[model samples]
Target: MDPDSVSTDNILLPRNIEIIDSKIVNLSIILFISGYISKVEISKFSHFRELYLLYIPYKFKLLLRGSRDGFTPRKFHESCDNVSNTLTFIKVKGTEEIVGGYNPLRWESSSSWGKTNDSFIFSLKNNDINNAIISDIENSTYALNYYSRNGPRFGNDINIENPNSQNENYNRIFCKKHHYKKKIRDSEEDFSIEDYEVFQIIKC
Candidate 1:
């Protein structure tokens, strides 16, 4: 072995990836809606799809009505991007915490408001982005998972109101909201960076 020879290790990843202004190839339509990023090879171009990104309404609110197209996950851009076995975060920072659950709304629609082919994209019909599934990450006050909120009451069509008096339902989940008996200091000193990171996610 040559003593002068040096070894190099690539350490620029697995922390947080950033998007430089230059790499904005195809503008992401469902950028916030879809979750992560992955890579794949096809016959020709390095095509991109709804790879990586997952449905965490914290990013959006529970904008849709049901779960992932009937409580199922689909491959957004199959042949082109070919990203599989990827982990998506419903959390998008303020801290490293993430919110988790099968996004109840995303699965209800085609997950797409429209249709698409190779070199382009589109939207699904009735593109109503008014999120019903409010969470602490989005509203930052209250939240309940699909199981917690999924009942006959939640399925009722939204009734928006601006009452003249003090009698109006403040569109919410859990009939009420979480009343914590004690305040948990989020920045607990004994926690390792990664420990607190995972703990922060609201696991549904």
Candidate 2:
């Protein structure tokens, strides 16, 4: 389906499926056409999308993919720096865990922190959305960290490091509870990632 053609007015639902809310139906169509989410994962992403839409209607556009664009801090900043309202997804290596965060401020290649109350870190359950955990910013002062040597960092809770490392599987990623309300991952140990993606959220 063409993403440009997606709208609440044109979306046709099956007769068997009851339309409870038009916003969710519209969000499902947009998420499906983006191809970043599968049919099974649409519901999970739809809820996340709705939260953003509550303030302003936004469309997610793919900015970077670790496997496709290279998993370096240089590569991440090249495509994502100066872009505001981005959603990042990291697929943990050797596991089904998907951890990510939403940055409402522009990313820069400088050593500084971006403060925002809307930013959040989360872990999406691969099969069940109910088990997913979302951690809101407990300390707004350290909501986001923009470091020249790191990819992305959500407070002191989660960070992607190793700008000097040549190996993609290097143990550079770390997740722990710090400035966030709760931990997204059960373990606070540093881990490698299978792949990661970043999407720019544009107001529609």
Candidate 3:
């Protein structure tokens, strides 16, 4: 079936939401957070199409397996479900905040991506690239570390809880574990979210 010919009637959109742009590409994801929404254009980046095609064959097989299988953590295991080597866009509530990161490797429950030190995270307001704050990640462990959880810890953003700090909104892309553990430790910085959406990054 032609993508352009597909109907979006089944696609859920919140009431009272303004349509930003009607132009549609191969993969356009509209993420709604607290009634506000943002779009992620798959064609804007690079190399997403090739990766997505690679997933198609596997996806057919996965569907077959799922028919026989009873359960799986499909939501949490984004990469395992076929969104490998993708960028996750997270939109948070308040101050037009957005925070997200890229996972360069496929997520597997058995391997945990094997100490991927190259992974990174970034922050932006109103989806403005000029106002973006890109940070190289120091750690990329699961939200749980058996003893202590570790994810992307930002600067001045304390991992430990502090009553005095005012930045209470926690916007993080946690992998396979709890979102409350790993933190971005920038006190002066704040990217809090009420909710978010995850899309498979595919470059056109």
Candidates' C-alpha lDDT: 0.21, 0.70, 0.34
lDDT of 2 by residue, 91-147 (tens): 887877778888879999778899998888877655344566778899999999888
Q: List TM-scores for all candidates, in order.
A: 0.17, 0.72, 0.39
Order of candidate numbers by TM-score, starting with the best: 2, 3, 1
- What is the per-residue lDDT of model 3 for residues 62-132, given as tens digits with 9 covering 90 to 100? 21111132112332343233434444444454546656554555444342333455555555666555455
**Per-residue accuracy of model 1 over 5-80 as CA lDDT, tens digit each:** 6533322223343221111111232332233211122111112221222222222222212123121111111111
Output the number of the TM-score-best candidate.
2
Top-lDDT candidate index: 2
Candidate 2: lDDT over CA atoms? 0.70
Off by over 4 Å in 1: 1-32, 36-46, 50-124, 127-136, 145-149, 152-204
Q: Every model's Cα RMSD, please?
A: 18.0, 9.3, 13.1
Q: How much does candidate 3 score in TM-score?
A: 0.39
Deviation (Å) of 170 in candidate 2: 6.0
Kindly provide the TM-score of model 2 when superposed on the true structure, using C-alpha atoms: 0.72
Which runs of model 2 end up more than 4 angstroms from their true locations? 1-56, 163-170
